[model samples]
Target: MSIPENARKYWRANLKYLAVLLLIWFAVSFGCGILFKDFLNRYSLGGFKLGFWFAQQGSIYVFVMLIFVYVWLMNRLDKKYGCNEPNSRKK
Candidate 1:
C-alpha cells in the first residue's frame, strides 16, 4: 500500500529529527563518557566527575528532556500538519 503524502512528509521530518537527536545522545553518552572520559574527567562539576556524571545521571536527565521535547514538538507538528484531533466541548 502507498503512504499518503501528508504521512510521508511527517514521517520524513520525524525521522530527520530522530536521527539528529540519537546522534547527539550517542555523542554525549558514549563518545564523551567512554571515548573522551579521561579528558572530560579533568573538569569536575560539584563533587562529581564530569564524564562519570554524564555516563550515570546526566544522560538519564538528557533522555528525560528528550522525551518531553519530543512530545511537545510532535504536538506542534500535528497542529501544523492539521493532524490534531478536534476538541470536544461539553454543553
Candidate 2:
C-alpha cells in the first residue's frame, strides 16, 4: 500500500522544519564557533571571549534550546495535520 497524500504533505513539512532548525544549529555551532571566531572575539560575554564562549558553551546552550523549539514546532505541526496523540498535553 502507498502512503496517503496528507501523510506525504505532513512528512514534507516535518522535513522542512528539521532542515531549517539543523541549518540554524550548524550556523551557530560551526559559523560562530569557528569561521567567525576571530570577529566574535572582539566582544566579551560574562568576561569570556564571545567566540570562545560560543565554541565552548553557547553551542551547547543553543542546541538545548533548539530541542525545545523542535518539540514546540512538531507539536503545532502534529495538531495541524491531526496527527497528535490523543492524550498529549497541551500548553
Candidate 3:
C-alpha cells in the first residue's frame, strides 16, 4: 500500500532532523575525541583538557543534551503534523 503524501513528507522531515543531530553528535564525539584530539588538547574546559574531556565526559554530556533536543524537536514536529497527543488537562 502506498503511504499518504503527508505521511511521506512528515517522515522525510523527521529523518532530516535525525540525520543532522546524529551528525553533530558524531562530529563532537568521535571527531573531537579522536581525530582532532591534538588540536583540542591545546584548550581546557573545567580544568580538563578539552579532547580528553570529550573522550571521557564531554561526549556523554553532549549526548544527554541531544536527547533533550530530540525530544523538543519531535514534540514540535508532532504538533506541526497534527500527530501530537491531546492535552491531558484542560481549563
Candidate 4:
C-alpha cells in the first residue's frame, strides 16, 4: 500500500491546519468562556463584564472570524498544494 507523495503532503497539511484552527476555537469557546471567566470578569468591555461578554457574545464573534480565517487559509493551502480549483470565468 503506497500513497503518492503529493497526496500525503496535502493530507498532512490539511490536518495540521485543522488542528491548529480547532485548538484556537476550543480555547476561545471553552477556555475564555468558562475556565477563565472569573479572571476576565475583573475587566469590562463597553460597560459589560468581559467574562460575561465572552461567554455570551465574544465567543460567537471569534467563531465567525475563525470561519473566515479558515476559508482564507484553505484557499492558500490549496494553491500551495497545487490542488486549487480551476478559475471559472467567461471572457
Candidate 5:
C-alpha cells in the first residue's frame, strides 16, 4: 500500500535527519572511539578514560538525545509545513 502524501513528506524529512545523525554517531563512536582512541585516552573524565567512556556510554546517551531532539524538531517542522493535525473546538 502507498503511503499518504503527508506521511511520505514527513518520512522523507525524517530519513534525511536520521542519515545525518547516524553519520555523526558513527564518526564519534567508531572514529573517535577506535581510530583516535589513543589520543582521546590522554584525557580522563572522572575515573573513566574519555575514549572508553564514549565508546561504552557517551554514544548511547547521544543517541537518546538525538531521538528527543528529532521529535521536537519534527513537531516544529510539522507546524511550519502545515502537516500537524488541526484541532477541533468543542462546544
Candidate 6:
C-alpha cells in the first residue's frame, strides 16, 4: 500500500523535530562537557564549574525538559493532523 501524502508530511515534521532535539542534546551533552569544557569552565553555575555541571547534571535536566517539549510538540502536531486521541488532554 502507498503512504498518504498527509502521513508523509506528518513524518517529515516529526523527523525535523527529532533531529533538532537530538542536536540540542548532543551539543549540551558533548560540546559543553568535552569539546568546549575549557571555555565553559571559565564560568560558574551555583558555584560549580559550568562545564562540570553540564556534563554531570545540566544535560540530564535538559534531556528531561526536551522529553516534555517533544510530548507537547507531538501532541500539537497530532491535533493539527487530526491524529490525536479523542480523549486526550489538551495543552
Candidate that would win on TM-score: 2
Sort by TM-score, best first: 2, 6, 3, 4, 1, 5
| List of clashing residue pairs for candidate 3 | none
Worst 10 residues of 5 by lDDT: 82-91
Clashing pairs in 1: none
lDDT of 4 at 83: 67
Q: What TM-score number comes out for model 6?
A: 0.91
**Candidate 1 lDDT tens digits, 1-91:** 9977887998888888788788888888898789988988999888998989888887888888888888887888878777777762223
Candidate 5, residue 21: CA error in Å? 1.1
Q: Judging by lDDT, tell me the better candidate of 1 and 2.
A: 2
Query: Tens digit of lDDT per residue, candidate 6, span 1-91?
Result: 9988888999999999999999999999999899999999999999999999999999999999999999999999999888898765435
Span of ten consecutive residues with least summed lDDT in model 4:
82-91
Candidate 4 Cα errors over 4 Å, as ranges = 86-91
Instruction: Flag the better candidate by TM-score, 2 or 5.
Output: 2
RMSD of each: 4.1, 4.2, 4.2, 4.2, 4.0, 4.2
Model 2: per-residue Cα lDDT over 14-72, one tens digit each: 99999999999999999999999999999999999999999999999999999999999
Compute each candidate's TM-score over C-alphas: 0.85, 0.92, 0.89, 0.87, 0.75, 0.91
| Pairs in steric clash, model 4 | none
Predicted candidate 5 versus true structure: per-residue lDDT over 1-91, tens digit per residue: 8867776787788888889888888887897788888898999988899999888887888888878888888888788667677662223
Tens digit of per-residue lDDT, candidate 4, span 33-76: 89999999999999999989999999899989988988998899
Residue 64, model 2: Cα distance from true site in angstroms: 0.7
lDDT of each: 0.82, 0.94, 0.91, 0.87, 0.81, 0.94
Clashes found in each candidate (C-alpha, N, C closer than 3 A)? 0, 0, 0, 0, 0, 0
